[model samples]
Target chain A: MNHLTLALDTMGGDHGPHVTVPAALQALSVYANLHLILVGDRPTILTIMRQHRASESERLRILHAEQVVQMGDKPLHALRRLKHSSMRLALDLVANGQAHACVSAGNTGALMTMAKVVLKTLPGVDRPALVTALPTMTGDPVYLMDLGANASCDSQALFQFAVMGSVLAEQVAGKSNPRVALLNIGTEEIKGNDQVQQAARLLQSTPHINYTGYVEGDRIFSGEADVIVCDGFVGNVTLKTTEGIARLLMHQIAQSVKRNPLARCLSWLLKGRLKKLFLQMNPDHYNGASLLGLRHIVVKSHGNADELAFLRAVEEAMTEVQRQVPGKIEARLQSVLLEKSC
Target chain B: MNHLTLALDTMGGDHGPHVTVPAALQALSVYANLHLILVGDRPTILTIMRQHRASESERLRILHAEQVVQMGDKPLHALRRLKHSSMRLALDLVANGQAHACVSAGNTGALMTMAKVVLKTLPGVDRPALVTALPTMTGDPVYLMDLGANASCDSQALFQFAVMGSVLAEQVAGKSNPRVALLNIGTEEIKGNDQVQQAARLLQSTPHINYTGYVEGDRIFSGEADVIVCDGFVGNVTLKTTEGIARLLMHQIAQSVKRNPLARCLSWLLKGRLKKLFLQMNPDHYNGASLLGLRHIVVKSHGNADELAFLRAVEEAMTEVQRQVPGKIEARLQSVLLEKSC
Candidate 1:
């Protein structure tokens, strides 16, 4: 395999270098051909690296950044004032061809805005989308897109999301012809608003895409479709609601186990199985979401991700880098648009 | 307390009389002041009633209807052609003052359309929203509204939903001053579409509602706010996503426990505690959703609800009827509208 270099936004997440440095080292141990350019304040990165006894080898280097983008800062504010922030510097490395991809556990809005401005959008794409892979019952991951990049979308935008999402699944998920469906309240053609209905018509008539009909939210994890498309508002809310419910249920289980003496005693025996189950369902395991439709691979890690979660994000970026996801998306989108115009 | 009579559409859900009949009987046993009028095909309902050894009393009666609304039937089709259908007849009973409330586990769009046409909207209300109570970590349920009543809502529509939802929380949930917030991708005021921002501004300025700025989807179960408001599209997707994730997690736990011998043994010992926890988080416990802003109370049950789930819906409707939710909403909305106009 060829060498893959990823620009690390070392001062991005809540704990910054403390989390990113350990995660980067762990990822390096897994991928022998991996290279990293850590972007952050130089002294902090160096100190953490020394603590881990990781040296600047041929595959790893540190790039100094002067400022940081606070999680609370607005996207526009970060763009204007924090031009030299770790997040922006890392994105610049990818745009300048110095890194194969970039990974950041930072403010989502800021990362999206800066990445779009720096890397630019792919050909025939107006706005980029946040796409993530979720575990499903069939053991195949489903790719869900437009996870909050654009708040409100029209029929045309939704159509674009479908195209982008299908390309991602085909190239990255290794699905030959990924079935794509619109997310709606009901499965009927006349169920949702005019925008969704119009998008559905377009998808149905398109020959280049395997466009399935509507899929309701309750069936999202059933693995019935490879790609599920929706407007950003709906997608974001659906994603977060799923996370919230998972957390709530786990909490309930723990509380119940503690209250009963028999359950508490039994919990000790079931600890290993319970741990494995919780690990599979943990949101941390699914940390990184690809910023699709951009000119380069940009993976956004969850802001609160710890070392293991952040390592998963680095692995996600590495996979995208090896697959050349953006190039595939651009080529597919151009052909689809040309066919539509004809 | 005055006797609360409920008109139940026995031919509504997937199993029709099988689920609704037993659920109604169970509900009658729970509430002494409860009365039910079962409307469906006479022979089928009678057969089920006799099998359950339930005979008509002063509080429980049978209202036969010649036709039934198929679960897949369109709302407009049901309204135009199936005037005497069981679902339509139940709404009519509420409209004609024979029943204080109506409960149906039927097609949602059809039920909403028929309810609005028969009962009409309350004064100054343009659309009725679907509002349901969700269990929260704080042990108090948070009321979420517009869970698929109107798919695409404007700023004014969202404002109306907030008003109606607040009234429901206060009257039925028994909160004196409900803290209501708009559901958005982010908690920032500028995070969502223009309609949401405008609605937030209106909510903040309104005197009656305790309008908190914004609530993100993940924090919805945190119990930070008493009421969460959004368009039907977002609300529906969020609610369904929560259900899906809960189902997925439970399935994971069951599978993992079965795979390990120790875990399987522990699961048997922990069965009682696990059962209680599952019961509390069960979607069936939160089945009924009220159609707020309607002139009379109309509760919608899950189409797939079993006997216990349907019983919970009946209990929910009884709670609303005893609380006089619609009457309270009418009075509060009139004053709020008057205040807004001035």
Candidate 2:
């Protein structure tokens, strides 16, 4: 927290430099002890900065990255071919301690692959799970993990995700012994697939984790549990499904208001409150997903994130850096390991 | 259409006779050509019928089914032990040609299992997938299938779902050459698990299916495709998550309206529209899911459905019966099979 330097993948996502550069300036203004290294094409980054009436300083450095990872590029291609890409360079900066964290509004698969290749995993971890914060009705944000990280994870991988998620909930969300539940179609013992049942067994045996049993999708926002863990495939689909409903409802309100005179009159007066509700309900666009169990912090923003969203992603990275998320997860794992050995 | 009869599992849902009896009266009034067999405790059904100022007649028969499949009953237990249960009896009526279709709001697992055991699957069908109609932006409801039927499905099962879904969309939703999409994390060739990728290959090779490639969860309500197919696990979670969001948004609106005076005034004026929007947005509660690929029609209402929702389920069963959904699916499969042999 003394002085934080974070790298930005300015040549990623749909908007690229247009969003990242403005977000970088905003982050610099918010965090007095913050430094941002913009990694992208030199001319475009500089031009965007100039357009925003800003210039590079000690706290703001422009690091030229020649290649840009396209949205359609496969993970393997991004890993093997685009070595000097902005996404890769930003992750490289984090790996070598040039920055405390890295933020990207890039293709998720590419970033996941590159971050794993560059920073490697924390010791005793096989895979890094993608964890995102979701708002609950109880005024606490529940952390859901493995959001399209490992499509078909083994029981061991799910157990590890539970540990990492617990660490996140405690360190970042500031919850004590956060209750963790496995996301399943049903809550009964007879429910879920083999891997989930096996993971439930593993979680039950672990002393440090406050393992609540399985939770169905309908209970996700009920605040019955602080953290929900599942294989990446299910998690990703569930997260996006939530986002889809948010979009659907927003669209429905708009269309309905247009047709209904009474609703239209009310909509004009409650515009601000309604906009905030829509924004607050949509977590993927407003917040970022952290790749937990990595050696360094990396937050993945939505691909089509606007300036405000990308800035929120940078803030997410800064918060993870301040909380030392990876360090705490490592420590928690060691203690769990010790308990098992005893 | 000829006279249609639907066997209702009067004691299956949480509300038992309270919801089903009132709903039966409504269905009888709506469809003059319809006859209903209410299967439950005879005394209770008679009492509820009397409450509605209706008595047993040729159009409405009360079949005594003493055993009730509880909401928490296991599928195996219901299948083996609860043969006289109202859910099983209703299914039995359909099997013996006493009823054209059966409607239940019992435990989904029990209903699915008993449905297969009594009515059986279509000759070439591996499993009977759960299909539901979701309201879309195009005003025509899109069909989604395998909503917790087979938790982990092979490519073959997924392909079968696609064929059945196409038939439903064409016959029921009346969408010609209905576009079918597989639900996945990304739309790339390298994205998704082995099952989904393999399923995509199968769909691409099949001539009858208008496979539109992969679609993410966020594109579900966009009306980009007529049918979306997924394994039971992801499909079930996606659906319940949608329901969860609907609940959360409704709760938020109520809570927020209470806090803001401007919003409160708007909410008062927009009360009817808001209620309709919320009800329309929550499909699981508004509509029942049909067990596709079955020999007979079986519509599973939401467990906690009210009288209106139960009435909708009765209407859904009647629609399928009039459309001869099972027969149409049989013919479509026969044609596809003939094409394959060529």
- Number of the predicted model whose lDDT against the real structure is largest: 2
Predicted structure 2, TM vs. truth: 0.97
Cα lDDT over the full model 2: 0.89
Off by over 4 Å in 1: A271-287, B271-287
In the range A157-239, model 2's lDDT, one tens digit per residue, is: 99999999999999888999999999998999988789999999989999899999999888999999999999999998888
Candidate 1 lDDT by residue in tens digits, B60-89: 899999988988899999999899999999
Considering just chain B, what TM-score does every model have? 0.95, 0.96
User: Which residue pairs collide in model 1, if any?
Assistant: none
- Across A87-194, the per-residue lDDT of candidate 1 in tens digits comes to 999999998899989999999999999999999998888899998888787878888888999998889889989999998898888998999999999998889999
| TM score of chain A per candidate | 0.96, 0.97
Clashing pairs in 2: none
